[model samples]
Target: MIRIEPRQSSSALMTYGIPVLSAIISLLLASIPLTFSGAPIGASYFEMFKGVFGSKFAFSEMLTRATPLIFTGLAVALAFRARLWNIGAEGQLYLGAMAAVAVGTGVFDVPGVILIPMIMVMGCVAGATGMAVPTLLKTKFGADEVVTTLLLNFIILIFLQYMLEGPFKDPMGLGWPQSSPILDQGMLPPLMDRMRIHSGLIIALICAITAQFMLARSVWGLKLRAIGENPSAARHAGIRVNRTLMSAAIISGALAGMAGVSEVAGLKGYLTSDLSPGFGYTGIVVAMLAGLSPLGVVAAAIFIASVFVGADSMSRAMGVSSYLADLVVSTSLLCVLVGGFVARFKFVRLIQKKEVTQ
Candidate 1:
C-alpha cells in the first residue's frame, strides 16, 4: 500500500525551503506557457533578471514597487496568524487610497512635512473602516468573517468606480476617470535623488520589524496565538478571543491601508482607479508563500516585486505579455500550499486479504 508519513522532525530549514523549491517549480511551469507562445525563453528570463536587479536604479525601483507589497503581505499574515481570513485587503486598499486623496487635497495645505503624515493617517483610518465591517459581523453577529470580507472586495471595487466617475474625477483630465492632482506637499520624500524610491520602503521595513517583535515578544501576541490554535480553549484560559481577533483585524486593515497610501502619495502623487494593480490580492499570495511569517513576508514581497519588475523587461525584449508575472506568483503559491500538506498531516492506506478467503 502507498502511504504518506510526516517527517520525524519539522525542521525550520524545511519550513523555509518549501518556498524556494516551489519558486523553482513555478518557474519551470511558467516556461511551458512561454514555449507554447513561441518565445525565446532563455532571453526572456534573462531580460527579467536585468530589469529587476541589473543596475542600482533597477534595484531601487524594485524596492519601490515592493513597499506596498510588504505592507499588504503583512496585513494578510497578521490576520491569518490569528486564524482569521482577511480577504478584503484589496477593498481596504482602495478605501484607504480614496481617504488619502480626500485628506491630502481637501483638508491639507501645509508643507510636505505635515501633509504627508496627515495623509498617511487618513489612509490608515479608511482601511480600518473597510475592515470593521467583517470584524463587527464576526464579533457581534457571529457571522463568518471570510465570506463577508471576500464579498466586500467586489463592493469596494464598485464604490471605487462610482467615485472615479462622479465625485473624484478630474474635469480637466480629458474624460479620463482619475483624481485631481495631489498637493505638492503631499508627495513622499524620495529615498534618493533621481530615483522613484520613497520613504514608504522604509516604512514597510519598519512595520515588518515591529510585527516581528510583537509576535515574538509580546503578551498580546501570545494571546493571539493561543486563540488561533483553539478559540474555545483560549477563551477558557481567559484570553478574550473576540477582542484579540478585533485587534488583529484592525491592525491588518491599518497595514493594508498604509499600502494604499504609499502607492497613491508616494508613487502616483494622486489617487487613481488603478491605484493598486491588485497589490492587496498579490499580498495574499505573499502571505501563503511566506507561511504567515512576518519576516518571511518581507522576503516574499521583494521576490514577488522582482517578478513584476522583471516581467516588464521580459515583455519588451521577448515580446511576451507582462501578465505572465501573475502566473508565476499564482503557480508558486499553489505549490507552497500543496507542499504544506506534508507538514500538517500523515496519510496511510490499509491492505485487506479477506475477500479471497470468502
Candidate 2:
C-alpha cells in the first residue's frame, strides 16, 4: 500500500522554474506533430523564434498581442486570489467592447483626451454591470458563481453577435457583421509610429503594477488574502467577506473590460464578434500558471504571446497547423497545474511497523 504525506510550501525556484520547464515540454510535444506532418521541424522552430524575438517589429507585435492578455490574466488572478469564482471575463469583455462601440459611434465629435477616458470608463462600468448578475445571484440565492458566470459568457456572445449582425452592422460593408470603425478621438494613441503597438500596453503594465502593489502592500489586500484563506476567520476578524468578494469581482470585471477596450480602441478599431482571440478564456491558464501573482502574470502573458506569434510564423513557413499552438498552450497549463499541486502538497510514503506477536 502507498501512503500520502503533505509537502511543505514550494521554494522560490520551484515556483519560477515550473513554467519554464513546462514551456520546454510543450515545445517538444508540438514538435512531434511537425515532424510527423513532413515539415522541417527545426527550421519551423527557428522561424517561430525569429518571428517573435528577432526583429524590433516582431517584438512589438508580441507586445501588442500580450497587452490584452496581461489585463485579462490580472483580472482572473485577482478574483481567484480573493476566492471569488469569476469565470465571466469573456462576457465582461463583450460588455466593455459594446460600451466602447457605443461611445465611439455616438460621441465621435468629442476631443481625443475626453473621448478616450470616456470610452474606457464606460467599458469598465459595463463590465461591472455584466458581473452584477452572477455576483448578486451567488450572494443572495446561493447560486454557484461558476455556473452562472460560464452561462453568461454564451449569453453575452450571442448578444454581441446579434448587435454586430443587426443594429451595429456597418452600412457600407455588404452585410458582413461588424461595427463602424471607432472614431479617431477614441482610438488608443500609437505607442510607436507605424506599429500596431498602442498605449494599451502601457495601461496593462500600469494595471499589473498597481495590482501587485495592492496585493502586496495594502489594507484591502490583507483582508482579501485573509478571506481567501478562510472566510469564517475573516468574518470573525471583522473583515466583511461578502463586501470584499464583491469588490474583487468588480475589479476583475474592470480588468477584463479594459481588455475589450484595448482590443477595440487599440487594435481592431471597432467592435466585432471575434474581438477577442479567446484572450478572456486563456487568462485562466495565464493566472494559474503565474500562481496568481501580478508580476508572474506579466511573464506568463509574454510567454503565451510569444508562442502565438511563433505559431503564426510556423504555419506560414512549415505548413504546420496553428491549432497545434493552442494544444501546446493547453498542455502547458495542465502541466503547470500539476506542478503547482505537487509543489504545494507533496506525497511521501509512510511506513508502519507492527510487532510479529501482535
**Regions of model 2 farther than 4 Å from truth:** 1-3, 347-358
lDDT: worst 10-residue window of model 1: 349-358
lDDT of 2 by residue, 199-282 (tens): 999999999999999999999989989988999999999998888888888889999999999999999897878888789888
Q: Each candidate's lDDT (Cα)?
A: 0.88, 0.88
Best by TM-score: 2
> In model 2, how many backbone clashes occur?
1
- Can you write out model 1's per-residue Cα lDDT over 1-358, one digit (the tens) per residue? 8678766776787788888888879877889889977898888788989998799999998999899999999999999998989998999998888988887875668888888889889899889888877998988998898899889989998898888888888777788888887787798778898999998998999999999999879998898888887889999998888888888988999999999898888888766777888998999999999888899999999889998998877888898888899999999999999888766556777676677664
Q: In model 2, which range of ten residues has the least summed lDDT?
A: 1-10
What does candidate 2 score on TM? Answer: 0.95
